[model samples]
Target: MKEPSPRRLPTGVAAAAGVLLIIPVLALLIVPLYAKKGPQLWGFPFFYWYQFLWVFLASGFTYSAYVLIERARRGERR
Candidate 1:
């Protein structure tokens, strides 16, 4: 009897998930983009508020990526 080969995510799904995961990392890694003191939000500077905003944005991105990967895996199982 032969063993079954491991399934791989489709190229498009993989790429999309990868990009979704990378967006937050890239956004926070580049410092100068949000390194500013103006545009205060409820007394928080742009720099502070910007990072705080990403906390939620990153969560959403991560969840979205996870869902995409899960769906792909489920589809492959069928």
Candidate 2:
């Protein structure tokens, strides 16, 4: 008997997932974009709050990508 082949996500879905994952990484890497002290939120400096916000944003992006990839895989399997 032959073994079942692994399911692969569609090219577009895989590219979209890759882009989603890269967004947070690229955002954090560009330090000058958030290295400021004004526009405080709840007494937190812009620098502090900006990075903190990305934590949630990154989680959301990651989750979205995961769901997209999973959906594509499921579709391919069927």
Candidate 3:
């Protein structure tokens, strides 16, 4: 028996998934937004901590996007 091909997401879902993944990268690229020092977390400056926090958030967003796309692809297949 031949194996079936993997399903693909619709254009809109794919676009949204791309946006979700790209947003964090773009946010990281724009350094000025988080570049600051007034705020501190246990001696960590705003700039340092903000980026560190995003490391977690970015992973979440990426995973969420992956799920979203997968769901969409599955729905289309069904």
Highest lDDT against the true fold, candidate: 1
Model 3 TM-score relative to the real fold: 0.85
Candidate lDDT scores, in order, read: 0.96, 0.94, 0.89
Better by TM-score, candidate 2 or 1: 2
* 10 Cα displacement, candidate 1 (Å): 1.0
Query: How do the predictions measure up, each by TM-score?
Result: 0.89, 0.92, 0.85
Point out the worst 10-residue segment of candidate 1 by lDDT. Answer: 1-10
Ranking, TM-score, top scorer first = 2, 1, 3
Please tell me which model should have the higher lDDT, number 1 or number 3.
Answer: 1
**Root-mean-square deviation of Cα positions for candidate 1 versus the true structure, in angstroms:** 2.0
**Colliding pairs, model 2:** none
Residue-wise C-alpha lDDT for candidate 2, range 31-61, written one tens digit per residue: 9999999899999999999999999999999
**lDDT for model 3:** 0.89
lDDT of 1 by residue, 1-78 (tens): 867868788999999999999999999999999999989999999999999999999999999999999999998888
* Comparison by TM-score, 1 against 3, better one: 1
Residue 13, model 2: lDDT of 98
On TM-score, the leading prediction is 2
